[model samples]
Target: MPRSTHRAAPTPPGGLSRRTPDAAVPLRPLGRLHDVASALTALLASDLKEHGLTAPAFHILAVLRRAGPDHRLTTGRLAAIDMVTCSGMTVRADKLEKSGLVVRERDENDRRVVHLRLTERGLRLTDRVLAGLHAREARLTAGFDADELRALAGLADRLERALQHSAGAFRPVPPPH
Candidate 1:
């Protein structure tokens, strides 16, 4: 009798193993992206804490500071941007006001309407926070060239837009007054 030989089958070009469960087929890339985002968020959260600001507070301050002094967003709008309830927005505004970082002004025509503005102290703090974050981001991306960064950013943008098209995508909620 002639000698018999046997060989194992090879995985395909994309590395999708035949042994993997059907449910995990498309989760690898998405899961990896989530992990990367979580890591970056943790780094940012630590930086924010070191500056005596929570992530939400820092985000709200940055948004207001970025808006020019002439025009301020209404509290409702801020709540929407923050994706929090109206009452939640008030709590944030209260904390910021106590810190002298933000001010609430009532509309002359409509006393019911209120707008949030950043104070000089808030502006200065936001600037410092931004600088630290930029430095941190630079450190994180030190290995990547501009082209690679752009490509990654482009991918993120596309993914974000696609997610937004879905009904379950998060939309900012108005804060409680």
Candidate 2:
């Protein structure tokens, strides 16, 4: 098997390693974090595939399920919620519509406006997918209790905010309304 990309630097004889540059001190942890995130995402994607869904597609289904059957949202809203391009959301919506998992309707009052809602099939699928995901997440965090989980989430949020401020290229992401 291939070695992990996030190998830690060996401690030198005098506790000063010369293999890595001084600038990489912070980057080492970040790299490890990225590695773990990438691996976890891949695992989640694999799980989704078994359900005949992709991560992006599941995000839409989950969002719709959360919004309830009567509260239909537009493609733009879904795109914003998923942090994806409108075209990306449209493509996912198209696939879901074709699969009979979602229904898209034109506004009765305005022909230009389109709204989306989950079908009965979609509702059931979303429930199963979300439940499985939640269970998988819990298993992945098996060592952590509720308090630890909350603390980890708080720390992660802090890291996200720090990166958002440090990265000039990042646009301001507003709280979901």
Candidate 3:
């Protein structure tokens, strides 16, 4: 038997360099992340729409739940965590309050500062939403075995660290309409 050999086709003159194919050049990893994020966002948004809430409103409820029984978070801190402007947060808080999902109270120690907290109804709603979210997450992970799931989680953590490092210097802008 004779050995076989393979050679890449030669590049066309004045075309893209052989080192980087115009069509096959490596793409930014962030592109894939963005796609995954957009899909997930759409799924969540659809779910929230049925409950008469937007994603941001759902997030506010979730944050309040995580803050424990007190369910209190400063407006400034919540805005920072939610990646929205102070005015935007105020508007969101106002809507949630009117919807009976949250309440605003003056901080005892800082009279000028307002603290946002979830109402009992808000807590119940959060619990229900979280249960649904957990079920969905489990379904997504159902195909993976324990070891594979662990490996996937580890890879995700590493990728998250890389993204966080790079994100400090990159401010995401809204995609063009």
Candidate 4:
């Protein structure tokens, strides 16, 4: 008779292995990514705080500034671009509006929808914020050669695309007023 080659699983204290061993292992790549993201977020948040804005608010202003000459973005579109909940985005926009950094206008073609535009002050502030951010980014990337910098940018872009693809199936809500 041939002997059985299968090995018995490790027994638990209670005489049963209720969960798989894989579940006990840490996800290293995810952990590392989270740590890096948190650090970057803190740095950006601190920089934006100096301008009396949060990272999300600064991003909103930047997006409006980069929009076409109309300088307007639909609330839904803004929320999508910012990758935030509609309600959360609405709150950010409200704060910006209160600070005289942005204004909400009713879309002419669609009365029910609102468009957001940066105020003159907002544009000026964004310009300053961008200059400062660019300086910081330059300092951080200074260690990298041109090719390495390009590669980093390309990788970042690809990562963003992958994230978007994964989350694209979820429907975005219209931003609240």
Candidate 5:
């Protein structure tokens, strides 16, 4: 080759691709956390799929079930609690309504506001799914002793708090034109 225009990207100490020069410093631990989270998500997703639910749908159902006897919440409030956009909530509500698991009702006082209420069928399904999920979770964590579990929970809590506190410090990079 007379002259090569291609240059291979440099690999960091652990042979991992570096997004930024400083990324290597935090990559390993964070990578492990991501891996564990992905595995847990897969496990949970499979369980949900068996019950004819996806993760988002399950989350909505769980939130409503937790809201007490009436099993009702304003769409805006549900969207906020679920950390999803109102439009996204609307889409989910549409699917749920079609499934006969939920219903939307205009607010009596304010016609502009809408509420989502779980149906009796939804309530029963949620209860059954939750029971199965809890048992699965217990089995998954059975290997961990109480002290280890506590320590892990404490560390995860700290990480969550730190991430929340520093949320504004990070920004998404724009794609190249």
Candidate 6:
């Protein structure tokens, strides 16, 4: 007889496969969550394109705008908040500085550190962009009633916390320094 190539699914001691019917149910919502996230990201990118800003650059401006009336943050802090490398933040800062959107100032007490402060032009632009994004988001959720929106937001927050907890298990070990 010819050798058989098919393999059977592995079953646990309880005689149930790891990929049980219950396991599949949770995945449907996860798939929908992915689609929603992707659509929102695309909308943001499209809006940013109209203002000649990449997502990261927009994020940098937004962070500074939220900092305070002075709209300042350290370059390193911006990198950490955006989860980008220092060099990457530097590149974004350089572009913003050249465009008159941000100014880089040396820390008074710590000469080694640099702070990025948004200029008047930068603040105005960030405000405009944020307003537009908020308006569009509101329109996107117009179909949902106030209570429904509140419930959805609460559920989303819970899902985010749950995912963060689960992600801890799969975090990769850091490379040796």
Ranking by TM-score: 6, 1, 2, 5, 3, 4
For residues 1-177, write the lDDT of model 5, one tens digit per residue.
344334336544453655544443335777768767987899889988998889999888888888878888888888887678999999999999998989999999999999899999999999999999889879989999999999999998788768767957533322211
lDDT of 1 by residue, 34-53 (tens): 66788789988998898889
Candidate 2 at residue 17, lDDT? 34
* Tens digits of lDDT, candidate 4, 1-177: 654445346533432432443333333554556666777889999999888988778878888888877678988888888777788789888899999999999988989898999889999999999999899889988899999988978987776667667857543333422
Q: What lDDT is obtained when candidate 1 is compared to the true structure?
A: 0.78
Cα RMSD (Å) between model 5 and the true structure? 8.1
Candidate 3 clashes between residue pairs 3 or more apart in a chain or in different chains: none
Preferred candidate (lDDT higher): 4 or 5:
5
Better of 3 and 5 by lDDT: 5
Query: What TM-score would each prediction reach against the true structure?
Result: 0.78, 0.76, 0.75, 0.68, 0.76, 0.78
Return the lDDT, model 6, position 154: 100
What overall lDDT, based on C-alpha atoms, would model 3 receive against the true structure?
A: 0.78
The TM-score, computed over Cα atoms with residue i paired to residue i, of candidate 5 is 0.76
> Ten residues in a row with the worst lDDT in model 3?
16-25
lDDT of 2 by residue, 1-177 (tens): 653445456644333333434323333666557667987999889988998998888878877777754646787788888788988888899999998899998988988878788899988998888888889888889999999999989988888888788857555544333
Which candidate would rank higher by TM-score, 2 or 3?
2
Comparison by lDDT, 2 against 5, better one: 5
**What are the candidates' C-alpha RMSDs?**
7.9, 6.7, 9.6, 9.1, 8.1, 8.7
The lDDT of each candidate is 0.78, 0.78, 0.78, 0.78, 0.81, 0.81
User: Model 1 — which ten-residue stretch has the worst lDDT?
Assistant: 18-27
What shift in Å separates residue 173 of candidate 2 from its native position after superposition? 6.3
Alpha-carbon lDDT of model 6: 0.81
For model 6, how does the per-residue alpha-carbon lDDT over 1-177 read when each residue is reduced to its tens digit? 554444335543433333543342223566667666987999999999999999989888988888877789888888888778999999999999998999999999999999999999999999999999999988999999999999999998788677668947433322211
